[model samples]
Target: MKKIVALVTLAILIFSCSNKKQGNMLVQGQIKGLKKGTLYLQKMNDTVLVSIDSVKLLGDDTFLLSDNVKDPVMYYLTFDGNTTEKRIMFFGEEGTITINDKIEQFGFNPEVTGSKNQDIIKEFKKIDARFKNQRLDFIKQDFEARKVNDEDKIKQLEDDYKRMMRKRFLFTAQFAKNNADTEAAPYLALTELFDANVRLLDTINNSLTPKVKASDYGKRLQKFINEVKANETK
Candidate 1:
């Protein structure tokens, strides 16, 4: 009889394990303060989990992230790349769970729903994309002028180039402040932008702007310096 009981217990354990889901999370919600943008659902452990197995987000204020969890773990919401004040998710139950919370992240009335933070992140992403697009066009044009060895025009680019970078730095700083209560998405975005644009601007100023290189590239660099400076004064 003991042997039979042991066999039954083993079978039950096996059955339960088999039924457990591997990718089993459905997080969804709406962020009322947003009009448009990309949002992220990033998980965190020792390091920030920017990328996850399931990439689920949409423009209609909905999202789903799936993963198996025997124990409850913490997840984050990335609104507009601001990660510090992210929405936290806890999965301690089996079936389905829901949550609703309003954040003072963006404004006094910014809200999140369904235990997920898809709403705020998406809206922020939209704004970030627009800002990037505006900057990219100028970057491309500045590069194009240099490709043909137009040494004269390089001086013109620098006036506001560095200043623009500083602006981006400042803008990202603001972003960091708005999302100050939760995860780390805003910080991550600010870090990346600082590297890509601000640091690059500094490098250009230090390495390429001065000493009057007088080459096509140099002319472009000068132009950026002038632009950055002019913008700064304004």
Candidate 2:
């Protein structure tokens, strides 16, 4: 009887180990103050957001999740599969990543590490925030000028706004060029240069390294450029 019980225990242990998911990327994190909840690791599949891995916490704030990452791409850490809000976005690649954040601020700002692509994005956002502020200033000035019926001020603001936009485009293009070897370069082009001039888009795309040009964002950027050029010819 004892032998049969031991055999059963061994079989259960083997079954549990086999059921555990193993992947190239490992994401482990701690959510302070989170005592009980479900955490989901998701990514965009074509256009749909799909959950690749998930963990439910009962009494601990720490969790571990992973996925088989083929290429570096943006992944979302959401609570209870909620993709609409409070989702922490990060670039995931082959390797272990660590994330730490408080439950209250959840997705507002999380310390993410272990991915070079993510570091590049963080650096870009710092400078991009300044441009965003300038844009808001221009919008406010335009609104006030319109309120006073100041046609001259409105025209001047319009010209200034156009110049600012041009400056921003150039900055983004140069930034992408500087990081041409990284996947972030193509990603920036796809997201930031969509409405930019075709020439600028082409410049960034051309600057991409062969490896980056083969990445997911790189392929998408190439396809987008092709579509734009095709439309221009029509």
Candidate 3:
């Protein structure tokens, strides 16, 4: 009778372990210089940011969170500390992901791994930064022109700024068209070029693959375009 009970307990243990390993994603992270706090794994459900998992860090700053991921989506790691709250956003995909960062600069810079989508996001940001820098330079020149009360120079700079903005918008549209197979395509259109002309938006939307157009962001892009058209008719 005792041998029979032991066999049943062993089987249950094996099954529990197997279930854990079958989860779609495993996020393991460690924060340096963190003595006590709570780490929350969060995702946006519609408009609300909901916590999916959390761990209390007493003496150790390491944590592991796992969940079943249906698609590549955005996830946030939020740290509730004694004096400050920090949050970091990343693209979460299937398989194991690792994050390492310091408590002081929690969200500013962190080493993240295990998602191809995140890598693509990083590349996009680099290109976007160049446009931002150019805009800032124009703003500085405009400021100088105003100080000198040079109306002609200011007008020329204003025209230059508008031309530069148009060029940036075209680049973003091209990027989205080229990467229509990836989630980043719709995301860029929605976030970066939502204020752009409807024709440009339509160009990107039409270029998307059927599979991509069926994704969450893809549906959002379609809805946004519809709303834009409605407003135009109004």
Q: Which candidate is the best by lDDT?
A: 2
lDDT of 1 by residue, 93-133 (tens): 23343433333343223343433224435455666776687
Best by TM-score: 2
- Output the worst ten-in-a-row residue range by lDDT, candidate 2: 13-22
Error of 2 at 43 (Å): 0.4
For candidate 2, the per-residue lDDT at 178 reads 99
Off by over 4 Å in 1: 1-18, 21-117, 189-234
| TM-score against native, each model | 0.39, 0.92, 0.85
Q: Rate the local accuracy (lDDT) of all candidates.
A: 0.48, 0.92, 0.85
- Candidate 3 regions exceeding 4 Å error are 1-23, 81-85
Ranking by TM-score: 2, 3, 1
Q: What C-alpha lDDT, on a 0 to 100 scale, does residue 175 get in candidate 2?
A: 94
Choose 2 or 3, whichever is better by lDDT: 2
Model 2, span 77-162: residue lDDT tens = 99987788788999999999999999999999999999999999999999999989999999999999999999999999999999
Model 2 residue 231 distance off true place after TM-score fit, in angstroms: 0.3
